[model samples]
Target: MFIVFEGPDGSGTSTQAKILAKNLEKKGLKVFTTAEPSKNILGKVLREALQKKYELSPKAFQLLFFADREQHVQNEVLPALARGEIVICERYNWSSIAFGVSEKVERKFLENLSSSFVEPDHTFFMNISAEKSLERVVLRGEKLEHFETSEKLKIVQEVMLNLAEQSAFTKRSTILNATDSIETIAQNIEMILTPMLFLQNIK
Candidate 1:
């Protein structure tokens, strides 16, 4: 199964993704964990461009993200899935939907662009308030990326929440409370997934 975790910066989604990977591994499952922009050359270029505050237009950014995602899915996601491993990704197509819209790119365009990729088995959206999330980022003292601001994150949060409510996500998506303790959040996820894991085991 391909599981994806997504949220604004400091929402703890990445942390949860790692914990969940470990949890699955503990169950004797082969788990693969990855994040975008990937560590590969194309992904690295996109990451550096953003960190350098390059003035990329929304269209330009979307193009680069799509390119990186294509390579990532082709080389990493598909291969891992073929090996019957549980693939957990920190971000995926939903990111394009959220961030693309935030950058004024048409949402339809992004959805169409990403339609070729395999759909995730489950998508966990770490829900959190913009103010609280921003506080966490400030406390971390990391260099601010272009989309790390409260204003942009607030919009991203709204987009995610709206998508979570849509029928496209209906039973396949989860909105996790980001305010909870890390252990509690991880336990919640494990509880939700345990039955599914067992079902897969039986098969």
Candidate 2:
């Protein structure tokens, strides 16, 4: 199964993804956990450009992200999934649609671009207030990247929610309230995923 976690910055997607992967592993499932921008050379360059150099235009960023994703799918995710391993990814095509396309490129073009990639079997969108998300990021003492501002993050968050609601791929998606306590959120995710995992085992 391929599962993707989507949300804005500081939305606890990383935290929940880790928890879910560990729980699945403990269940004796073969699990692989990864994220994007991936650790590949293309991904590394894109990550640096996005955060440190700030030289990437919106179209450039979008294309770089997709390039990294193509490499990621070919190198990591698709292989694991083909082997019937449970794959968990933090962020995916949805992030590009929300942040890169909506802000800079046309929505229809972004949708078409994303359709070329492998869609997740299940995606979890962690919803949180933009203000709270920004606060959490600042509290973590992380340096603010060009796209890390509260305003931009809010727009991305809204776009993600909207896209999830409207997209056919999101029929398998679950929206979780990310403002809740960590334990509570984890429990909610487990509740949603465990049954599906069990069903897969039976199949």
Candidate 3:
């Protein structure tokens, strides 16, 4: 299954993704865990530009993200999924749509561009308040990235919530409360996902 996790920064996606992948591996299932703005050359350059230099126009940023995603899909995601392995990605096309639309990109164009890519079989939307998520970021003592400000993060959070509510992507999406403890939240996600994995195995 192509499972993607979406949320604002500091939403514990990385932590949970690791735990879930490990648990799945323990079950004797092959699992591949990765994230966007991947560890590739193209992805690394864009990630550095975004985080350190803050050097991309809104349109350029969107395109670079998609480029990284395209490379990631071609080189990593598709291969694992084809082998009947579970592919857990930290972010997917929805991240671009949410971020792009917030940057004033036309919604229709963003949606169409994103739809051209493969959609996740199931997406876990880690829901949290903008204020709370920001606080978590601060507590982590990380340097501010281009999207770190309260204003920009608020916009991203709003876009994510709005998409979760209205986008067709939500059909295969599972909403998780991110404000809970890590263990509780992880358990909740596992409860929702374990059955899906079992069904796939039977088929």
Candidate 4:
């Protein structure tokens, strides 16, 4: 199954993805963990752009994200799925829509760009307030990326919340309160997934 984690920067999606992957691996399941922009040349360029190394139009930036996603799915995600491993990714199609829309890009254009991508079997949206998100980023002591500001993240969170209710995501998405203790959130995810993984293993 393909599982994805989505949230604003500092919302703990990456941490949760890693924790879940590790827990699943310890249980003898074949698990593959990855994030976007992936570890590719295109991803490298995109990361630099995100860090403000150079500015690209919102459309151009989103396109780069799509390109990187295409390569990531074809060369990494697909093969792992074919091998029967559980694929857990941090950030996916939703990130593009949320971030792009927050940047004043057309939502329809973003959706069209993402139309050809593979949808995750399940998505976990780590919902957090903009204030809380900024607080966490400050605690991390890392420089903010392009979309890491309080105002931008507020809009991004709103966009993601709206996305969660859309037809494409409604049935397969779960929203978690990101302000909760990390262990509590992780336990909730493991509890929700354990039965499903058990059934998969038995098969």
**Local distance difference test, each candidate:** 0.86, 0.86, 0.83, 0.89
Write down the TM-score of every candidate.
0.95, 0.94, 0.93, 0.95
Per-residue lDDT tens digits for candidate 3, residues 1-203, read 89898998888889889999998888777888999889999888887876767677888888888888889999999999898788999988778887777677776777787887888888888888778888999998988776776776777778887777665354688778889899999999889887787787722
Predicted structure with the largest lDDT when compared to the true one: 4
Per-residue alpha-carbon lDDT of candidate 1 for residues 1-203, written as tens digits (9 for 90 to 100): 88899888899988999899887787678998999898888898889877864778888988898899999999999999999999999988888888888888998998899888888888888999888888999899888787888888888889888877772345888888999999999999988788776777722
Error of 2 at 195 (Å): 1.7
- Model 4 is weakest, by summed lDDT over 10 consecutive residues, at 194-203
In candidate 4, stretches whose alpha carbon ends up further than 4 angstroms from where it belongs are 167-170, 199-203
Model 2, range 1-203, lDDT digits (tens) per residue?
99999999899999999999898888778899999999999988987886767686788788888899999999999999889898999999889888874456777777789899887888899988789889988999978876787777888889888866765354688888899999999999888887887788722
Off by over 4 Å in 1: 167-169
Residue ranges of candidate 3 with Cα displaced over 4 Å: 167-170
Count of residue pairs whose backbone atoms collide, per candidate: 0, 0, 0, 0
Model 2 segments more than 4 A misplaced: 167-170
Please, what's the RMSD in Å of model 4?
A: 1.6
**Judged by TM-score relative to the true structure, which candidate is superior, 2 or 3?**
2
The TM-score, computed over Cα atoms with residue i paired to residue i, of candidate 1 is: 0.95
